[model samples]
Target: MKKKDKFIIIDGNSLAYRAFFALPDSIMTISGIITNSVYGFTNMLLKIINDNKPTMLAVAFDSKKPTFRHKIFKDYKSDREKMPEDLASQFNLIYRVLDVFNIPKYQVEGYEADDLLGTLATQAKDKGIEVLIVTGDKDALQLVSENVKVIFTVKGISDVNIYGPEEVIDKYGIGPNYIADYFGLIGDKIDNIPGISGIGKKSAAKLINEFGFLEQILDRVDEIPAEKIKEKLKQDSEMAILSKNLATIDCNSPIRIDIEKCKLKKFDEKKVYELFEYLEFRKLWEKIKKMNLMEKSLKDENKFQSRTKLIVEEGELINLIEKIKNLKEISIQFLGSNNDCTGIAISIKPDVSFYIHIDSKEKEDRFFNLLKPILINKNIKKIMHNAKYQLKILFKKGIRLQGLIFDSYIASYLLNPHFREHKLSEIIQKYFGYIAFFNIYSNRAITIYCC
Candidate 1:
């Protein structure tokens, strides 16, 4: 039998709030636009995609308009603090990033993100698609069932706890169906839901496990062994019911699931790379590049093949130098260490590159001796990534590298001083719009592209 397709629904507001608090606000773009929330959210998104490999994905965002729960209680989430300006400023950027990924995002005026998640999850589950709900809110646990699981953000944005039916039972001492009942007994301070005066988690779990739900517990309140507990349940019965209603997620939200639209497909890698570059997400780009998530454009794909020639003979090396003798600039990359240099690749033009293998001491000495004039020429400009390392290696070989004009590593750092590390693959993808492959073996040499 074929495996069922996985559909993931994300609570965007809850995740953004959690990420905003988990990461430091010091993470901002060069223009002073705060990006901690977006950074964390995107990080979590990439990780989820890499790990789960979901076929269908969508994000549900909470609308600015008040939901039905607010109208019912008139004080729903009244105690919650206002959203921070820094986090609020990044919501548009987050939306743009989601668009670049082609992930469908929905926001209904009269429902919270939880309601949309519940509705979509139920719809997908009924259609035989495996559903995963990603959120930081515990209120989403009530939606857990056999076919649906909740990926609850436990701490920060990375640490998470997945909850199935049995996991929910283990955590709450009752099944997922009774999560709202438990919440009703013990009020949710985060949402300002008022439960019974003294009921807590232990009492709520016992009451839920004993009875069926909030109504059943209230109906059987008279049979309680403790007088005070029974009195609280009976006296505050209306409040308990209201709290449960508030905690319950509405599965019939005003929305429909478009499976085809939610299905993951190839996205515009160039647009995503440009956005990351503008946002100065150097490290995130590197992570995505390492994961091989970005697809190369047609132009790049054609430019990346069979253009590297290996020169093992003296005649070939002499011809290669003659071809590059008058070139204004060239790109160079050295493989291996100074003492045990394996090979060197040189690009005299956009379409052509040559790798000279260094097997024996004689070959290494001869190759450098033939190329030393160009290497030490002050007029022919040389470009590299991490020029300092290459300069050190060349100096150790008794050949001084001259006319060093451009270093992509330094350029990346200068572009974003906040970045901790600058990688050549990331820089190439960010600016050149594609990754250049560089592979070297113990006995064989492959051409490396430095453009």
Candidate 2:
């Protein structure tokens, strides 16, 4: 048999809510934008993608409008508190993250995310595809079958329990199909579904296992062995039916499932990097770099070509200085430390760069003297990765590095203070999608200049 295509459906609202409460609210950006929910959600998403490697994936989000359950039952989810302002604010950011990952997201006006997940999972399962439904809601377990599994979040965002048909049976003492029935007999306080008054989990499972469904048990109430249980069933038969209706996930929700569109594909690296940088998700950005899910554009490749000129002759050095003298800004990378200056790389333009080797003290002195005017010019701005360190090296040589406008290392640190080490190679790879090759041990610097 051909290997089945794996389809992963996420309950966006449920997972986001879980994540919001899982992490502390102190996880904020430099601008005080709280990102606990987004960070946790993205972390969970990355883990799922890395673990399952699903062929197709999508996230189903709940809309602001009241769903069909609310229409049928006015008390549906009425007991739940209003969403926190901080968590609500992060939803759009999470959506942007999904877009960057090239993952399609769906939200229907009158349907909950659970219904949407059910619809997609059922459709995929019917087509002989393996379906994985990710949610914190236990109601999703009803969707589990031979080719369907429910990744139920048991604790916080990280810990989870996977429920196949067998696992569902093991847990509930009933198959996945009777989950709604079980909930009908035992009310859900969270959703405010009024199940039978006297029935609990054990009694609910027993009834569901015996009579197959809520209707069957209600119809055969007189045959029940326990008189008190039968009376409770009779008294709350209508409520039990309503509760089952409320608890049951609608597998035929009015949404189309385009399997081809849901296929996991390469995402635009630049856009993803921009969003990550904006959100200040340094660890996640680093994680994405390791995943290598980005497609390098031909433009990036064409714009970056190594055309390095080794300036050995004095005439060559003078020509380079004259060429870049009038430029408003330039990028410089220093190789080696202050004591042992090895070489210096300068770039006047994006594609044009030059490197001058400093093997002896005489050569270092001569190079600094020739380039001192341009380097010390306050009008001509300079950009470097670690400006402070480079400034120290330049200061020791009596060349005060002026017009230091941007320091990428400091910027990266501000973006993510939790980062242990903000290396230039990692920064280049994160933003430019280019693997910078240099000898760290030898203190060699590879400079790619861009305005």
Candidate 3:
């Protein structure tokens, strides 16, 4: 069977609102442009692209004008708080970022982003294309099906919960089609949807699971076991129906854009860099640099290739150290276990990579003694991944490692602090488009040139 194309439809307003509140308002640019929402959105967008490798994408935004739901029910979403000024200010900048990436964006004058997502997803599913709806809105759950999945943001941008038909059943105890009915009976105080007065989530799910939908429950209200619950359902029958109408997303919204228009393409790196600079996103700028470097390295593999050697014999170790004694710049990788210094790799130039193993205390002491002069030489630059970890291990061996100029570990942290670890392979793969063949003990030295 042929593979189906993957399309990701995002609810921009829902995610933007969630991101703004999830992050602190203090993430402001140097020019006083608040970027909490923009940063979160950018990260989420990149994460989805990297994780899913979607073939097409579109972000649907809510227009400033009131939606059709407002005309149907004047009090619809009336109780929701207005967007804060700081977050609102970042919307245009976010749009600019999307433009730089060449991603299609859509908004209808009288429809919510959810409706646009539903429409696109429904259309894609019909064409045998898999659809992934990304949002923080629970209303999107109604669109879940065999070909459509909803990725709901659980906490900020890092954690998410994906819902297929089975997940929807597991989470809500009803089929995807019953979500609107469930909300109709239980009510959504957040959206000010007035469901049945006495029904809660459990009651709503039980009724929907037992009788199927809201109309069925209402039609047989008299058969309900609880008299009080039945009385409330009878009294609020009209409101329940109205709530369902409001909660139901219009899957056939008149969205006219062709799916081909949403194909993913290379972004304008220069423009993206300029935007990052203008926003003063220093950490994000580093990431952009890495991405650009990776692309370049992939396009020209030979340009980043270098020679390397691992030394285990004592004679070979001394000779290599002697060869690069006068080198002005060098990179080092100290390999150790249980705080015991075990081996080291040194790369003085792109063509020269050396590694030495310390098999015993005598060998370890002899290696450090021979290399200590170069390490202390202020004129010579030393580079390594996580110099502190190396320094700590050397400290335990009664040696002081110094003259360090670049530490890729701290650099990686500053670039993306959310990552759990900045391993050598991860850094190399991220910046070079392929995993490094050399392990932590072997390739730690050459990472100095990754930036």
Candidate that would win on lDDT: 1
For candidate 2, write residues 1-451 as lDDT tens digits.
Answer: 7767999999999889989999999998777899999999999999999998898999999979999999999999999999999999999999999998899999999999999999998888888889999999999999999899999998889899999999999998999999999998898999999898888899989888888888999888889999999999888788999999999999899998998889999988778878887887878977986886887641344344446666777789999888888899888878778686777878787777777777788888888899899998989988888888888888898888789898889999987676678887666766666655542223545343332
For candidate 1, what is the TM-score? 0.88
**CA displacement after TM-score superposition, residue 387 of candidate 3 (Å):** 21
Least accurate 10 contiguous residues by lDDT in model 3: 292-301
For all predicted structures, in order, the TM-scores are: 0.88, 0.81, 0.67
By TM-score, the better pick of 1 and 3 is: 1
Candidate 1 ranges beyond 4 A from true positions: 290-295, 301-307, 324-335, 375-388, 397-425, 439-447
Q: What lDDT does model 2 reach?
A: 0.86
**Reference-based TM-score, model 3:** 0.67
**Clash pairs, model 3 backbone:** 311-355
How do the candidates rank by TM-score, highest first?
Answer: 1, 2, 3
Best by TM-score: 1
lDDT of 1 at 252: 98
Score each candidate by Cα lDDT: 0.86, 0.86, 0.80
- Model 3 RMSD, rounded to 1 decimal: 7.3
